[model samples]
Target: MGEHRDDLPLVLLIHGFPEYWWAWRNQIQTIADAGYEVAAIDQRGIAGSDKTPNSSDALTLAQDISAIARSLGASRIVVVGHGRGGQLAWAAPALAPGMVEGVLTFSAPHARAIQRPGTHLTLRTWRHVLTTFVPPLARRGLTDPVSLEHLLAEWSAPGNDGASSQAQIYAAAMRLPEAAGISLDQLRWSYTAVQRPTGRRYFELTKNAIEVPVWSVRGQLDPLLPERAWRQDHTFTTGNFRQITVANSGHFIPEEVPEESSQIILEFLHHVAHQA
Candidate 1:
């Protein structure tokens, strides 16, 4: 709605942890050009946003999206989330079905898929669990720019380390004491939520299949999230789910392939809008 006052639909973009609203910088204007109200907000505890331990929980994060949509005067919202943001995207529709129109996740899969036994928990997952249990080392690592650079290098497709280019910016943003603490909180909470015997937060999310159209996009070389786990998933309430893979891409699809990612998102939103 920056320049166009027409009743264009609303699309909320949520970035993953250790990143900020600027992470979606590539898609904001492009999506707006597609005739939709676009908002790229820094999720809680990330850069330029309020710090809160609640961002660690998926359901609560989803609630943030619903509340934002209401404020925008939209009855239903289209969501696009990446990495940890993608996890919240899935939970959003499940938590507030009547508020979400269609959902799109980038470089992330459903939390339910990852929690199942058949799912393969990669080294990256174990590393997150370890860091959560040990805080002193975590604080040091979180503060180090090299650590951030390393994550960007290791997570993306080979020969495409998106982290190196933005390491300076990210390091500066995460340097804030509150940002570091909130990140640590996410790791700790994620470990507890997954290891608990009866307090599984994702189970509550799965009780009802997401009652909206769902789309997933993954980086072909993202080691943290293997493709096998998503092969037979039918968790969408509408059962109208589709997955897209970008060639030679890693975990940070938007950063790595903005044009392709933006185009895909614009197309998906257009489809949803047409059906409405």
Candidate 2:
């Protein structure tokens, strides 16, 4: 593959579930302005990218990353992922160590095993449950206009901000019930495969000690990922990691606080590159 340009280092920004490349609208422009070659693609079944018939298990998603990077002519890259994409960020490096140069994740645990210590983690497990159980019901409900709006509102961040339009476009792309949320078929297949023993093995590989430098960012007020809960989790490597807590943001860090989010990423990249 041919490089886009020699002056700019390639950075592959991967999006989380319920999102496509549009999720990183704020970060993409900022990174590009800073003179980096940035390419943010829709993950499978998300947007302009191909929605393959196979399961969207963690390994399949990670392999997609390798293909995306190589297709963009990136010999190695500074990879960034958020939320569910953060899970991919952790997994991709361990699964294909030689291809990734640096890693950054936001608002979610890296490939570490799910450690449910108390009611909170157990309650948070609803994400998996809902995705598994409600997709069919959701598909049916989405057939209604009112239900479709509700689904879009739920999948999207609920606030009028700079990123709100981007969120709307993303929500419109779901199109399962004609621009609602994920289809029952997508949900059923993904959940079935991800819950398997082999799926657990792939996640284990992602959590395996990533020798490359890593950064984790979270917001103090994020509802989905509470600061206290994340602080108590010990799955990631502490010695080689850095954590930044934004004062009053939420799980959707990129949208909640774009400037701060972008700044933290820029700083981490500079520090890691200098150390290298």
Q: Output the TM-score of candidate 2.
A: 0.81
Q: Using Cα atoms with residue i matched to residue i, what is each candidate's TM-score against the true structure? A: 0.90, 0.81
Global lDDT of model 1: 0.75
Q: What is candidate 1's lDDT per residue for 158-223, written digit by digit as tens?
A: 777564568768878888758877777765665566675332756665567765678899888777
Question: Model 2, poorest ten-residue lDDT window?
Answer: 176-185
- Tens digits of per-residue lDDT, candidate 2, 160-204, equal 243444544654566642223333444443345446765766755
**Which lDDT value does model 2 have at 200?**
68
Tell me the RMSD of model 1 versus the true structure.
2.4
After superposition, which runs of candidate 1 have C-alpha atoms over 4 Å from their true positions?
1-5, 53-55, 194-202
Q: State the local distance difference test value for candidate 2.
A: 0.64
RMSD for each of the candidates: 2.4, 4.1
